[model samples]
Target: MCVYLLRGIAFSKDDSIPKTGKAAIENKLLAEAVLESIIGKKGVSPGARLSLAERLSQLMKENKVEKDATKTDNQDEANDVSLGDKLAKEN
Candidate 1:
């Protein structure tokens, strides 16, 4: 599933990333590309790409770990990011 997700994201080597086997690294680069694609759309450097990738990877890991440790039975009944939050952030 992890590999499938990475493949779907298309961060594999020869894409927009340097030669690396780390999926999260690739995922981060892919994410940056999306962001740049929205705004500047310029290619980011290797260092920035790797750093962003690492940070994003850590965030994803933390989110998963938190979710796994959370109780399933009727918690807050709200997500971490709600529609209200999204609208507020957008504004």
Candidate 2:
């Protein structure tokens, strides 16, 4: 699953975004390193290792798409009502 996802990212046609290409390469290398580390481990089962790889890949993809923290904080602030304001409104 991770392999297929990585392949899709790596082979994506749109090279207009440099960051996306860099992320794909970074993820691929990280995945390779992790797989190598787990290849001969005695304690972890194969299924567990594969699950970890899949989750890691998913997380990497999600991280790439995540919004900026400052933007999210601004949105939160816009949506939030102060406790004092809420109390005054209730009265």
Candidate 3:
């Protein structure tokens, strides 16, 4: 079921859609939502669902790491500007 959905998504990826950046992120979110829903449905064992949940958690963690890295880079740039201002004021 997941494979079929993935294949459909892959086939749908064409010139009509943006393939990188925000579009890519949106696609990933959609895929994750679909998988989560499937795993959350009836008939799946708790252990198997737990494994899927762990994978989802890891995925979210990776995304947070990327966002944190970007935020850190921005903060560094801001700090550099502030530091330069301090030095100028001391001069």
lDDT of 3: 0.51
lDDT of 1 by residue, 1-91 (tens): 1112333333434335534455453476876566465333254445444545675688899999999887466556544577888899999
Q: Tell how far residue 65 is off in model 1, in angstroms.
A: 0.6
Alpha-carbon runs more than 4 Å astray in model 3: 1-38, 72-91
RMSD of each predicted structure: 13.2, 12.7, 10.6
Whose lDDT is higher: candidate 1's or candidate 3's?
1
- lDDT of candidate 3 over 1-91, digit per residue (tens): 1112212222223324324332232476776675455455662445546644665688889999998776654656756667768899999
Q: What tens-digit string does per-residue lDDT give for candidate 2 at 1-91?
A: 1223433322233433223434433476776665555443652346545655676788987877774433554767878898999999999
| Model 2 lDDT, full chain set | 0.53
Give residue 49's lDDT in candidate 1 (0 to 100). Answer: 49
Candidate 1, residue 33: CA error in Å?
A: 8.8
The ten-residue window of minimal lDDT in model 1 covers: 1-10
Candidate 2 lDDT for residue 47:
54
Relative to the true structure, candidate 2 reaches a TM of 0.28
